[model samples]
Target chain A: MTKKQIQEKIAFTVLTMTMFMVVIPTLLIIGYIIYKGIGTISWEFITAMPRKGMREGGILPAIVGTIYLVMGTIILALPLGVGSAIYLTEYAKQGKVTRLIRLAIMNLAGVPSVVYGLFGLGLFVYFLNIGTSILAGALTLACLILPVVITASEEALKSVPQSYREASLALGATKLQTIQKVVLPFAMPGILTGAILGIGRAAGETAPILLTVAAFFLPRLPKSIFDQAMALPYHLYIISTQVPNMPQGIQYGTALTLLGLVSIFFMLATVIRIKFKMANRA
Target chain B: MSKISVKDLNLFYGDFQALKNITLNIEEKKVTALIGPSGCGKSTFLRSLNRMNDLIDGVKIKGDLKLEEQDIYQKDVDVVALRRRVGMVFQKPNPFPKSIYENVAYGPRRYGIKTRKQLDEIVEKSLKKAALWEEVKDRLSKSALGLSGGQQQRLCIARALAMEPEVLLMDEPTSALDPIATAKIEELIVELKKEYTIVIVTHSMQQAARISDETAFFLMGEVVEVDTTQKIFTKPRDKRTEDYVTGRFG
Candidate 1:
C-alpha cells in the first residue's frame, strides 16, 4: 500500500478508538443507573417522607428541596449574570477595567466548590445572618454558578454580528433600545442554554450545599425559607456513607437517583437547545 | 434645498486621515451616488453623515457637518435623535435574527409606538414601499434568516423604511447580492427618492451610470468630480476621473 493509505488507516483507527472510549463509558454509566433506579422509582418513593431507612423511605422532601433550590438559584443568578454579561460585551470599553473584571470572573469559575461553600457560610449564614436556611444555600449556589452563566452568556452575546447593532443604531435605536429589541432576542437561546447548564451544575452540586443548609436530614417538609433542607446529592452521601450499615442495594439506588436527577436536568437543557435550533432552521 | 452640507470635513483614525478636507451640498429628496476605488473614504464620508463613526474608538474629526441646516457636531446635539433622521443600509445584508414582522416593527416599537394597530400599519406600509410586502406577506412569522439572500436584503430595506427617516444611506448594499437582487435594489432606490434623500456608495461603474442621478467620484480621499450622471459618464472631465471611469485604472 502507498504511504498515504497507511496514514489514512492510522487516523481512522485513532478516531474510532477515541469515539468508542468516550461513548461506551457514558452509555454504560447511564444504562447501569437506569437499570437500578427504575425499580426504586415509585409514587411513594418520590412522595414519602424520610421516616424509615432511606431504602424503604421515599425521597419526597429531597426532591422538593432540590427543585426549590434550582428555582431559587435561577431566579437569583440569571438576571444578574446576563445583565453583567451584556454590560461587558455591549457597553463596556475594552480597557484595563474590563480586562481585570473579565479575569476575576474567569478565576471565580475555577475556585473549588468547597471554597464557595465556605464563603457562603461566612457571608450569607454568619455575616448576613440568614443562618442555615434554604435561602442561604440557594444564594450561595447562585454565586457558585454566576461566573459560568456570565461567561457563557457573554460568549453567546458576542457571537451575534456587530452589524446588527450597527443597523439598529443607524435606524435611531438607542444603545439600550438596540440591546433590548435586536441583540437580546437574537442571543436568548444561547443565553438560556448557558443558564440551563449553570442550573444543571448547581443541581448536581454536593459539596457546597453540604456545608450549608444541605447538612440536615430532616424527616419533615421545610415550612419556609429558613427551614433546613435535604438535597439529592446530600441524601446520596448520607445514604451511602453517613447512615449506619446501609444496604449495598440502597447505596446503588442512591447513586442511581443522583445520576438520574442530573441527567434529567442535562436532557432538559439539550431539549431546549435543540428546539431553538429546529425553530431557527424552520 | 440642501438637506446636508459638509464644510472642511477631515477625519483621522489615530493619525491616518481617512477623509480629506471636503465640502459638498446634498439636496433634499434626490439620489446621490458616491463612487470610488477601495479605501477612497466614500463610505467613511457616508458614515460621518449621521455620526455612525462615533461608535468607533479613537476616530477624530475636525469639521462642520449640518443636517437640515443644524450643525450635527454640536456638543449638545442628541446623536440618537440625529440618527433617526438618517437611516443606513450596510454593504452586506444584516437582518436581525427575528421574524420578518418583528424586524420591521422594531424601530417603531422602540420609539413608543406600542399600539398593535399602529405597528401593524407601519410594517405593512414600509414593506409595501420597499416592494417586498407581496413576497413576504405569506410568511411574516418565519425567521428573517430563513429567507433567501435577495429576500433578506429587501427585508432589511423594509426594516429601515419603517423608521420613517428623511435620508437613506446605502453603502454598497448590492455588492454582496446576486445580479437579480442588485437590479431589484436599484429599482427600489429609484422609487425611494420620491420621498427620501438617498445616497449610495458603490464600486460598480455601470451601476453608478445606470441608476444614479448625480455621481461623486473620489480619489485619494478627495472628491475628484460631482455632477449629473450623464455628464460624468459621457463628457470629458478631469484626467484622473475620466480615466478611472473608462476602466483604465481603478
Candidate 2:
C-alpha cells in the first residue's frame, strides 16, 4: 500500500526477527537441558555424596561448595563495591581522575575469567599461601565480580534524586548522616540487586575456582575456609569432559544442578527488585 | 529587630555572578518574601541563609552574612549547627521515600533522639505546626510518597519544623501546587510567622502582596526595593519597583 506503511512494516519485521534470534537460542539451550536432565534431579541427587569414582550417588559436596563460595564472594564484594560506588558517585569530583578510574573499572570487567584464574593461582594459592581452598576461590570470584557490582551500584546511587540529598542536608544532617539515613536506604534495593547478580556470576564461574579450589574427588564437605571444596561448575566440567566414561545421567544432572542454583539467585534478585519497587510506590 | 543581616553580599557561580551587592535585614517573626523574574537570584539569596549554597562546587561568596550577630561565612562556624538553627523547604515537594512519621522524625533522630515516644511527640507537634496533623495523623506510618503534591509539600515543611529551627527558608514552597493547595500553604505561612521568622521566594506577585509582611523585589541580581509590603505596593520608591508592581515588566 503506502510507502510509509511499507517502511514501517519492514522496520518492525527486522526488530521482531532480531528479538527472536536472541530469545530462541536462550530458550533452546534451557529447554534442551531440562529435557535431558529433569529425570536425573532428585532429593538424593541433590543431598547425597558422590561414589564409584564420581559416576554414581549424588553431588552434595559440590552444592555446598557453591553455597560457600557465593557467600564468601558476597561478604567480600558488597561493602567494597558499594563503598567505591558511593565515593565515585558522591565524593569524587567529575574530572580526569574520576574518568580514568571509571575507565579502569570498565576494563577490569572486560578481562577474561581465565586471566583471573591465573592471578588467583599466583596470588591466593602460592604467594599468599592460603592454598587451594574455599577462601582463595571466593576471594578470586570476588575480584571477578567486583566491577559488575561497582558499576551497578554506581548506577543505583546515581538514580537517587539529588533533591533527597539537598532535603536531608538542609534539614541539618551532616553529609555522612544524610548518606547513611537517606541516600543509602533509597539506593539499598538497587545495590542488593547488583550484589545478587554478582553472586550468581560468582556461583556459575568455573575458571577462577578451578585453579584456586575445586577438589576433584572430595567426599566430605569443607569444614574450614582453608579446606579445598568441590564447586558446581567445576564438578560439571569434570564429569562431562575429564571423568572417563562418566554416566550420562550424572553429567546432565550436574549441569542441571548448576543451572538451578544460578537461576535461584537470579529469581531471588527479581523478587527483591519487585518488593523494593512496591515499597517505593507505597 | 533583625534576626538575620546581610551587608553587600555578592555570590558567584564560577564566572557568572548570581547575586550582587544584596543588603537586607530580615526581622524576627516576620514573613519576608523575595519576588523577581526567573534567574534574578531570589532563590539563590534564600539558599544563602543556611549555607545550602556550600553544597554546590565552584560557588564563591563575598561580603558579610550574619545570623544573630554571628558571621555564618566564617571558617570556624559549624555549618551543621547553623543549618539546624535555620531549616529550609525547597521549591518542589521532597518528602523522603519513608513513612510520614519517619520523614518528620529524620531530623531529631540525627540529633540523637532515638526513643519512639519522643519521636512520635515531635512528629505530631511538627505536623500540627505545619497544619498537616489532622489530615495525615492516621497515616503517619504509611509511606509519604502516597500523599498528594500539596500534602507532600506540607510534609516537607513539617520535616523542617521537626528540627525546631528559629528561621525557616522556603524556596517557592507552593509553585508546584494547585490553587487550593497554594491557599492552604499561604494560610500556614501566616500562622507559622507567630513562632519562626520566615523567608520565601515566590514568582507570584499576588502571593507576595497577600502573605508577605515585607517585600523585596529583585531585579538582575540586585535588590530593587525592600520595604513594607503595603508601602512597596502602594507608594513605591523606585521606578522599576513601581513598574514591577504595576505589571509593566518583570
Chain A TM-score of each model, in the order shown? Answer: 0.93, 0.97
Candidate 2 lDDT (Cα, 0 to 1): 0.93
DockQ of model 2 vs. true complex: 0.73
DockQ scores of the candidates: 0.65, 0.73
Clashing pairs in 1: none
Per-model clash counts, in order, read: 0, 0
lDDT of 1 at A213: 81
Docking verdict class for candidate 2: medium
lDDT of each: 0.86, 0.93
Which prediction has the highest TM-score against the true structure? Answer: 2
lDDT of 1 by residue, A102-163 (tens): 99999999999999999999999999999987899899999999998999899989988899
Expressed as tens digits, the lDDT of each residue in A1-282 for candidate 2 is: 899999999999999999999999999999888888889999999999999988889999999999899989989998999999999998988899999999999999999998999999999999999999999999999999999999999999999999999999998899999989788877878898888879878998889999999898899999999999999999988888888988798888888888898888788778877787776655
Model 1 Cα lDDT, one tens digit per residue, B146-236? 8888888888889889989999999998999999999999999999999999999999999988888888898888888888888988884
Candidate 1 overall Cα lDDT vs. reference?
0.86
Error of 1 at B40 (Å): 1.1
